[model samples]
Target: MELWYTEKHTDSVKFSIQVDRQLYSGQSEFQRIDVFDSKEFGRFLTLDGYMMLTEKDEFIYHEMMVHVPMAVHPAVKRVLIIGGGDGGAIRELVRYPTVEHIDLVEIDELVVEVCKKHLPQTACCFNDPRVHLHFEDGLRYIRHCEDEYDLIIVDSTDPFGPGEGLFTKEFYGNCYKALKADGIMVNQHESAFYADDAIAMQRAHKRIVQSFLISKVYQAHIPTYPSGHWLFGFASKKYHPTADLNGVKWNALGLKTRYYNTRLHAGCFALPNYVEEMLRDAE
Candidate 1:
């Protein structure tokens, strides 16, 4: 017999992977967590039966999420990450010598511990001195914070289950209040290829523009994720993602990033025709 792991991307569409073995499976206070080993993607983790990250392509998502904002504002010192329990985003963040502090607020503590045990590649950076772990609801955490962080990264799951609140307009308002004057916020904007995700992408874009002076969406090709085309939300109070970006300064950092580069950072924000219409009509 062969063991396979499957997730429903839609009612009629499903994705399956041939698993070498199941490393872990248990339910936390929040959702079901599972980790598996596969020949193609290597080790991977899922929350509530949804694929969160895989070892092979994990660098793409992590690099894109952390590098884009850092490139635009190299002076960023204080940062906050909400819902990145896997630690991939933080792994990229602590690389910047300019960063002085980072607060990682994750609602589920079990996800962090489990990932630390089985997904060490992405989870290895939790011990960085700059990172202060807070096992609490991110929505509630940001709601109570004011003018605290130079950047906020919402590395959340889909818009259902534990991640639902992070996608709401009210939460975006709280995130706006949680940022400094020129703060930049990046979030997991769902893909535009599917109907459900496109609706989510547009809705998120509409709500973010209400609170941010500059709002834009960017794309990344994550082969394991649904549709293989993923999007990220970029919003700021005072900087254009490209116009104010000092690419020359960012390149000078000389980081060895597999997926994100200075040129691609600006290019990703150039939305496709259909994607542009989706965001335009979202308002």
Candidate 2:
């Protein structure tokens, strides 16, 4: 008999995966988090019929998501991460010894518990002392916070249900205010290949341009995500993503990383011609 696992993504959505003898399934309040053992991707996490991360290839997603901003501000100390309960972003942030504090605001506590229990390698940094966990709405939390952070990493979900407010202009404006003078905010800006997401990027870019002096969208390849090409939005009041790395020390704690490095730091910003053309069209 063929085996198939099914999970309820939403009232209107469901996800299923099939293998020779194995079946895996789960259903979230909004999007079900399901894990499957695939030969090509190893262990993969899927939400609402969409792939969020894969074990063998997670480094590319986590590294590029974290390091691009860390490298931009080599002296990043106080950092804020929104919706990164799996600890992938925290794991990468702790690599820089200069970081003294990190606040992670995650809406769903269940995602954190599930990842920590079922996905150790992906959720290892949840136990890190420097990282503080606050289960709440990130948008509301940042608005009330008076402490200005050096870096704000928006490691949230796709814009649909719970994470919809994260992409709003008012949220972006609050993020700009919640940061220090030279602070930077990085957001996962969906896929360049997705026509629907292009409008989302344009909207975010418009908001950032009005608030921050420098705003740009960068691309990374994430196999698990839709379209396989992901976008990241960087907004800074002072520094550019590729201004100068003259005497900066990255991965300062002798941390071994699979994807992010000094060379990749510069190379990640090198966008494809099509992606560049799309951004140009937006302008």
TM-score winner: 1
Q: How many residue pairs clash in each candidate?
A: 0, 1
Query: Per-residue CA lDDT of candidate 2, range 129-243, in tens?
Result: 8889998899899998653899999988878777889988789889998999889999888776656666777666666677778887777777556566788888887888887
Inter-residue clash pairs, candidate 2: 28-32
Off by over 4 Å in 1: none
Q: Candidate 1, which ten residues in sequence have the lowest lDDT sum?
A: 3-12
Estimate candidate 2's alpha-carbon lDDT, on a 0 to 1 scale: 0.76
**How many backbone clashes are present in model 1?**
0
lDDT of 1: 0.93
Candidate 1 per-residue lDDT, tens place, 60-104, comes to 999999999999975899999999999999999999999999999
Candidate 1: the clashing residue pairs are none
Taken over the whole model, the C-alpha lDDT of each candidate is 0.93, 0.76
Cα error, candidate 2, residue 76 (Å): 1.1
Alpha-carbon error at 183 in model 2, in Å?
0.6
RMSD to native, candidate 1: 0.8
